[model samples]
Target: MAISNVLMFGMVDFSGLLDKFGIDWHLLLIQSLNFVLVAFLLYRFGFRSVARVMDERREKIELGLKYADDMKREKAAFESSRAQRAESARREAEGIVKSAKDGAKAILEQGKMELQQQSAGMILNAEKEIARRRKKILGDAKAEIGTLVVEVAKSVLASQMTDRDRNNYAAMAEKMLP
Candidate 1:
C-alpha cells in the first residue's frame, strides 16, 4: 500500500506549488530575455574586442622574440668569424716574422764566411810578397858581396905582385872567372 501511494505521488502534478510560491511567468520571461541580451552584448562588444587586442599583442611579442633570436645568432656568428680571422692573421704574421729572421741569419752567416775567405786570401798574398822581397834582397846582397871581394883581392894582389909575375896571375884569374 505504501508503494502504491509512492507511485501515486510520482504521478501528481506540482503547478499548484508555483502559485503558492508567488511565481510569475511574465516576470520570469522578461528576466530571461534581459540575461540573454546582456550575454550577447558582452560577447559582441566587450569579450571579442578584448580577445582581439590580446591576440594582436601576443603576435607582436612572438615576432619580436623571433627577431631578437635571429639578431643574437647573427651576432654570435660574426664574433666567431672575427675571432677566427684574427687568429689566422696572427699565425701568418708569425710565420712571416720567423722567415725574415731566418733569412737575416743566413745572410749574416754568408757575409762572415766571405769576409773570412777574403782575409785568408789577403794573408796568403802578404806572405808571398814577403818571400819575393826576401829572395830579391838576398840576390842583391850576394852580388854586392861578390863585387867587394873581387875589388879587395885586386888591391892586395897589386901591392904584392911585380909586373912580370902579375901577367901570369892575371891569366890564371881570367881562366877561373865566368
Candidate 2:
C-alpha cells in the first residue's frame, strides 16, 4: 500500500521512505499487540501485587487507629471510675473523722458530768461528817456541864449542914414522905 496519500501533517508525506524501509500495516498491528500484551503482563505481575500490599497496609493502619481509639476510651473510663471512687472515699473519710470528733466530744461531756456527780457526792459526804462531829462535840460538852453541876451542889450542901440540923431535917423529911 502507498503511504504517500497518508499525510501526517499538512506538508509531511513519506511513501517512498516507508516502502524502502519495508514498514507495513501488518508490522504496526503486531507491534501494537505486543505493547498491549507487555503492558497487561506488567500490570498483572508488578502493579497488582504492589497495590494489594498497599491495600493491606491501609487496612492495618485503619485497624490500628480503631484500636488506639478504643484504648483511649478505656483509659478515660478507668480514670473516671477512679475519680469517682476517690471522691467517695474522701467523703467517707470525712464522715468518719466527723463521727470521731463527735464521739470524742460526747465522751468529754460524759466525763464532765461524771466528775461533777462525784464531786457533789464527796461534798455531801463531807457535810454529813461535819454534822456528825458537831453533834458528838455538843453531847460531850453537855455531859461535862452536868457532872460539874453535881459536884458543886454536893460541896455546898456538905459545908452548910450540921449534926442537929441533919437530925431535924431527917424528921421533917420522914413526916413529909408520901
TM-score for each predicted model, relative to the true structure = 0.54, 0.58
What's model 1's lDDT at 121?
A: 90
Report the lDDT tens digits of candidate 2 across residue range 1-178.
Answer: 2464455542344666777789899999999999999999999999999999999999999999999999999999999999999999999999999999999999999999999999999999999989988777766654554445434544667767665665555455445433
Note the clash tally of each candidate.
Answer: 0, 0
Cα lDDT for residue 107, candidate 2: 99
What TM-score does structure 2 among the candidates reach?
0.58
Residues 35-99 of candidate 1: C-alpha lDDT, one tens digit per residue = 99999999999999999999999999999999999999999999999999999999999999999
lDDT of 1: 0.80
Give the winner by lDDT. Answer: 1
Highest-scoring model, TM-score: 2
Which residue runs does candidate 1 get wrong by more than 4 Å?
Answer: 1-13, 20-23, 117-178
Alpha-carbon error at 90 in model 2, in Å? 1.5
Go through the candidates in order and give each one's C-alpha lDDT: 0.80, 0.79
User: Model 1 compared with the native: what TM-score?
Assistant: 0.54
Candidate 1: residue 111 Cα off by (Å) = 3.4
Off by over 4 Å in 2: 1-45, 140-178
